[model samples]
Structures are given as structure tokens and as C-alpha cells.
Target: MTIRVVVADDQELVRSGFGMILEAQPDIEVVAEAGDGEAAVAAVREHAPDVALLDIRMPVLDGLAAARRICAGSRCKVVMLTTFDLDEYVYEALYAGASGFLLKDVRRDDLVHAVRVVAAGDALLAPAVTRRLVADLVRRRRAEAATEATPDRLAVLTAREVETLRMLARGLSNAEIATTLFVSEHTVKTHVSNVLGKLGLRDRVQAVICAYETGLVTPGAP
Candidate 1:
């Protein structure tokens, strides 16, 4: 199916450039454009696109706030990310429910790929921007344990389930986790599902964020 899209940015050139790239893709169609945050929300509700590529800084409403509003109201996947991979707005955008992010300087192929990835219901990290927040390993572990202290859904996780979750937070892909733990890929997939369900998260994006915010995974760590 064609992935319907909306490009929202205050800059005319940025919007136009994005439109051009999306328009060239057979699987992606630029359904609308919004020059500001409020208009972006309006356009998204009207067009009901499969994905909304939102810029963080826009007039009328900032992309971060707009993403929160849009994601709250729409079923569409929201990839509220940026052109500059290091743009700090990205962190807030993720907290606001962006499914994927990319730098504006990202190659055309990578840009298009990000859209497709999010549209498929996956969340993405800013490419190569793993965090460097410096709580020591012990402190980090303590923080993670604390963040999960009152998780409403932990009751649902088995001992094995929790083990799978920690490894996932460590950034191991399903295949890798499976190999490391000597399990099948299908088994890992089942554990991932239970983790999401028990944690009350929307997808892997939120899970990744939880992994970070709860101090389970530090981006820059090995």
C-alpha cells in the first residue's frame, strides 16, 4: 500500500525538498503540507496520512507540541524528527511520540527508508546519536531499577520475560538476543510482545525510550 505522508516545516524550501523526495518514491505519496505546527495538526487530521514528518521548530506551534497533539488524536504514525541529527529537539519529539527520526542531511534513500520503517509501526533512534548521559554503571542500574519500581504492568512478566526485556534494552536485535540466549527468533518475538503488553507501551520506540529514561540503556555505552 502507498504510504500517505505530510511534510510540516516553516521553511518553504525544506517543505519543498521533502515533498520532492517523497513524491519520487513509488511507495510514498505526499498528501499534504503544513507551514506551521497548528496547520500541521489540521492537515494531518484532514488528510489522515500514514505518516507525519514534523519539524521541531515551527511557528504557530512547535513541532514537539504538535507531535504530541497529533499523535494523541490520530492513528497515523508520527515520525517527528529532524534534518540535523544532533538537534536536541529530537529528544522531546520522541517523548512526544515520534516513531522515527533522521537528520535533514540524511541521504534520500535513508529519509525514505525512515518513513517506511515508522509506517510499519516501528520506532527509530536518531541515527548514530546514542546518548552520553554520564551516570556511572551502578548509578545507571539504580536509576533503571527505580524507574521500573512502580510499573503498573510488571506483574505480568515472568522471570524469563524480564530477562528478555533487559537484553532488549541493551539494544540487542531479536536475532542477536536469540543467539546470545540460545533461543529461537520466534521465542524472542514472543518475549518482546509480553514486555510491551506488560509495560503499557505503544511500540519498540517507547520501549527504547523506557530503556533510556529508566536507565536501562545508555546510548553511548558498549
Candidate 2:
């Protein structure tokens, strides 16, 4: 299936650059482009694209607001763009339901791959970068007391499912989680599906956040 996308950025050059890169892919199509958050939201409403690539900083609406509006009103997955992986807004975007985060300096192949990864209903985040982000959030909030093995919100999941979610928050792929648990990849996938379903999460990104919020996975813990 062709994955339709909308590229939103305040810079004309950035918009064009992403557009050019994505349009070059056979299975991906850049159906619309926006120069600001409002336009981005409008384009998503009009085009109903499968994915929306938004810059973290934009005029009129800003990417976070645009992401919130788009996610609330449309089914399009959001991939936030940033110049730095450590941008403070990265965690906010994840909380706002973004499926992925990408550095503006992303290489050609990584950019293409990010779009595909999120389009396939998976969340994308650089593991090392995301670890820092999560740790930072934990530090600022002094929520160390929040780390509980079984939070009320996660009461619906079985013990095995909770373990799967912890590994996910640690940035383990399904295969990695399978190997760690000495289970088949298919079993890990099943656990992941059940975890998401029980938590009512949209994707792995949200699941990671939920794990942190519920204290299933504590920051700075080995």
C-alpha cells in the first residue's frame, strides 16, 4: 500500500528537502506540504494522509499543538522533526501521541525508514537519545517514588505482559525481548499486542511512556 504523507515545517527549504527525499520513494507519496502548524493540521484534514511529518518548532501552531490536533482529529501517525535529539519537546511529543521522532539532520535512508516504521504501526525513537530524554524527565520531576512494580493502571496486564512492556521501554525490539526471555519471536509479539491492547495504547511509543508513568520501568536503573 502506498503511504501518503504530509511534511510540515516553517522553513521552505526543510519542507522541500523532506518532500524531495520522501517523493523519491516508490511506496511513499508526499501528498501535501505545510509551512506552519495550522496549515499542517488543515492539510491532514483535507488529505487524510497515512503519516504527517512535523517540525518540533513551527509558527502559528507549533508542532506539538499540531500533533495534538491531528492525532485527536485524524488517524494519521505523526513523526516529529527536530534539529537535536535531546530537544526538550521530544517527550511532550510522545505524550501527545507521536509515533516517531527524527533529527532534522537524519540521513536519507533513516528518514525513509522512519516513515515506514511508523506507517507499519510501530513507534520509532533513537534508543540512546530516548534513554536520556526519559532519564531527564525522571530527574526533573523527582518522581522516583512513582516507580512501582505494579501500578494500578497496569493492573490489567499479566506479569509476563508487564515484563514485556518493561523491556520495550528499555528500547528492546521484539526479537531482542524474545531472546532475553528465551521465548520465540512470535510469543513476544503476542505479549506486546496484549500489553498494548490492555493499556489502550496506540503504539510502542505510548507504551514506553506508560511504562515510565506507571513506574513499571524506572529511569537510571540497570
Candidate 3:
């Protein structure tokens, strides 16, 4: 299936550059391009693309708000674009239901791969970058007492499912989780799916957040 995408950014060069890269792929199509958050949302509404690549700091709504609206109202997945790997808005974007994020300077292959991965309904949970970002945010939230502990929200998950969530929060991919539990990757996928379904999460990103919010995983822990 062709992966239809909308590339949104305030910079014309960045927007077109990404469009060019994605358009070069045989299975990927740049369905639309937007210069700001409002246009991004509108493009998603009209195009109904498989994925929307939105810059995090767009004017007239911002990517976070656009992501929330798109993810809430449409089946389209969102991948936030940022200038920094550890952008401060990472947590908010994820909570806004973005499937993942990409740096503005992402390599051609990595950019294409990110869209494909997210289009396939997987979150871009890079252990190195994502884990540190999530952990840092969780720690800050805890310090400010802004994060109300709600570990009981995980009560609906089975013990094994809960274990799976913990591993997910640790940034382990499906295969990694499988190896850890001595189970097949298929079984790991099943548990991950069950964890998301039972917890009412949209994807692994939300599942990871849930695990942390529920105290199933702690920051700075292995």
C-alpha cells in the first residue's frame, strides 16, 4: 500500500526537502504540504493521509494542538518534527497522541524509515533518546508533585501484560521484550497489544507513558 503523508513545517525549505525525500520512495507519496499548524490540521482533514509530519513549533496553533486534534478526530498518525533531539515539548507531543518525532536534520533514509514505521502503527520509541526524554520528564514531574501517582490504573492488566508494559517503558522493542521473557516475538506483540487494549492506549508511546504514570517503571532504572 502507498503511504500517503502530509509534511508540515514553517520553513519552506525543510517542508519541500522532506517532501522530496519521501516522494522519492516508491511506496511513499507526499499527499499534501502545510506551512503551519492550522494548515497541517486542515490538510489532514482533507487528505486523510496515513501520516502527518508536523513541526513542533508551528505558528497559529502549534504542533501539539494540531496533533491532539488530528489524533482525536482522525485515524491519521502524527510524527512531530523538531530541531532538537531532546525537545522540551516531546512529552506533550506524545501525550497529544503523536506516534513519534523526527529531528529537522534527519537523514534521508531515517526520515523515510520513521514515516514507514509510524505508518505501520508503531511508535518511534528509540531507547537511547526516547528513554532519556521520558525519564527526565517523569523525574521533573515528580519533583514538582505535578504527577499524581495512579499505579492502580494498571489493575486491569494481567501480571504478564503488566510485565510487558514495564519492558516497553524501558524502551525495549518487541523482539527485545520477547527475548527477555523467553517468548516468541509474536507472543510479545500479543502482550503489547493486550496491554494497550486493556489500558485504553493508542500505541506503545502511550503504553510507555502509562507504565511510568502507574509506577510500573521508574525513571533512571534498568
Please give the lDDT score at residue 70 for candidate 2: 92
How many backbone clashes can be found in candidate 3? Answer: 0
lDDT of each: 0.75, 0.88, 0.88
* Candidate 2 C-alpha lDDT tens digits along 136-165: 665565455545454388889999999999
Candidate 1 lDDT over 8-94, as tens digits, reads 989899889989999998899999999999999999999999999888889989998999998889888887656675566665666
Collision count for each candidate, in order: 2, 0, 0
Q: Which is the better candidate, 2 or 3, if ranked by TM-score?
A: 3
**Candidate 2, overall lDDT?**
0.88
Candidates in order, TM-scores: namely 0.81, 0.90, 0.93
The TM-score-based order of candidates, best leading, equals 3, 2, 1
Better of 1 and 2 by lDDT: 2
Q: Which stretches of model 1 miss by more than 4 angstroms?
A: 130-155, 181-186, 218-220
Question: Candidate 1, 154: how far from true, in Å?
Answer: 3.9
Which regions in candidate 2 have their CA more than 4 angstroms from the true location? Answer: 139-151
lDDT of 3 by residue, 96-178 (tens): 88888888888898999999989987888873787777777667666777654545788898889988999888888888989
